[model samples]
Target: MFDSYSISELGSIFVMQGFAGLILFSVYLLMALGLAIIFGQMGVINMAHGEFMILGAYVTYFTSQAFQHFLPALFPAYFFVAMALAFVASGTLGMIVEWGLIRHLYKRPLDTLLATWGLSLILQQVYRSVFGPREVGVELPAWMMGSLKLTDTIEVQINGLFVMTLTVIITAVVAVMMFRSRWGMQVRAVVLNRMMASAVGINTERVDRLTFGIGCGIAGVAGSAFTMIGSTGPTAGQLYIVDTFLVVVFGGAQSLIGTILSALSISQTQSTLEFFLSGSIAKVITLLGVVGILMLRPQGLFTLKVRR
Candidate 1:
């Protein structure tokens, strides 16, 4: 039923599609950035990353309920508080998991993968038991529930803009921490050469825990943001895991810059394709393209100089 439209109509469709792509890019970046840090810097395969994200979403849900019940006056501001709480909740869980399990598996990356995969299953079941099998709807404040119309046919949702802004702020903050701070120097040193860094008196273990926690924390924030645009279920995080991994792997696991680039490229490509084809078909084509490119350049779009 679809056909070519007038110039004005075509322009409106393109604008709407581009904005949609931007929202998708922001979510993908958030999901990939955390995995990039843990996998690239610490060499730990956190297969449970998606579960950590779900933890954040659940935290936000509860935060909203609390605000609605006890602080009705602050209901409009629940999202900010929810975001902060989600970070802390997910980060704390990450720290505990690191101390309890991941710390011992640092020397065994493959083993960590299997362990975290099992942990992910455990977390999923726990969420199902606690929250039930149905998806819970997160209540967005009225301010975030509408759209901004650029023209009669062109409109952008406020929530999408909020997510895009959040992504930009998070990316800038992370870039600063990675490139400008002394801790960032230590993190890079550890990533480049763990034994050498340890020999130089760097507390590599501390760095590892912190890096993992930060990664999980970011995932939480992402999950919280995602509730605005997607369903929130016990298994909602699973839906994004594949795409998140695709972005991180295709972007180059060791580079945040690569992660952002990969997310944008993939999101834009998928969005454009989705406008023409069914979502399932678009995804299939996009994935096949990614696989073909990866087969040609196994190291991904970017690679660090360090030998692994």
Candidate 2:
């Protein structure tokens, strides 16, 4: 296949692949960032992370429906409202779970995993009962249902660009909240030493709830963004969970910089392979490669030096 293509044609293909890789990186980072905050910062394994994303997707779907039926003039702009609602809906559920179940299991990290896993199943069933088993297609506005012509031979989907932009904005805002603000300091302190943070007058419980809520909220945003590229269903979240976990763990828990780097590396590698191979083979190769490397450095790519 390569022998027939001219150099310029190959270059264009490579560029297109790179763009696709970047979009994939953005999506992965968005999904993993929330999990990182919950597991890495709060030491809680939120198995319902994918469900939270599904909630967001559902919210976006409903928003689109409402706009199309009742507010046709605002069809294109419904996405903004949908995004906000998804964040609130998922964040509220996260806070509720934290208070109702997670709070009791704070000292028992392993139990939280089981509890959240059960919650995930419950949520999935509820979604299935309400939405049925079939996937719901999200309707995009006319303005968003097109592609941008980058060059004579290369064109990119507008939705991909939208997701990339959303990812950048969310990353910047989260970075600022995690590193530059007083709440961020408290969050870091709590992650570093929970007992010491409590001793120093930090409200550890509040921090925990907020951190988890933020994580879920980010997942919701990711789901909303994903409506452009994938299906919306109860099980849609399951598709991304494994990859999300891979990014979070491989990037190193509690390290935003590490998450971004790992997501970029994994996405680029997987996307490139996908261009030449089937999706399943590409995923298997990526997972095996990550597993092999992680076996050598169990602490991941960027281990924090805080005393445990």
**Candidate 2: pairs in clash:** none
lDDT of 2 by residue, 206-261 (tens): 99898888899999998898888888999889888888889999999878998999
**What's the C-alpha lDDT at position 264 in model 2?**
91
Per-residue lDDT of model 1, residues 1-308, tens digit only: 24667878878877888889999999999988888888877888888999999999899998999999999999999999999999999998999999999999988888999999899999999999998889987889999989998889989999999999999999888889988998888999998889999999999989888888888999999989988888778888888888988998899888888889999989988997798789999899999999998999788898868555
Candidate 2 ranges beyond 4 A from true positions = 1-4, 305-308
lDDT of each: 0.89, 0.89
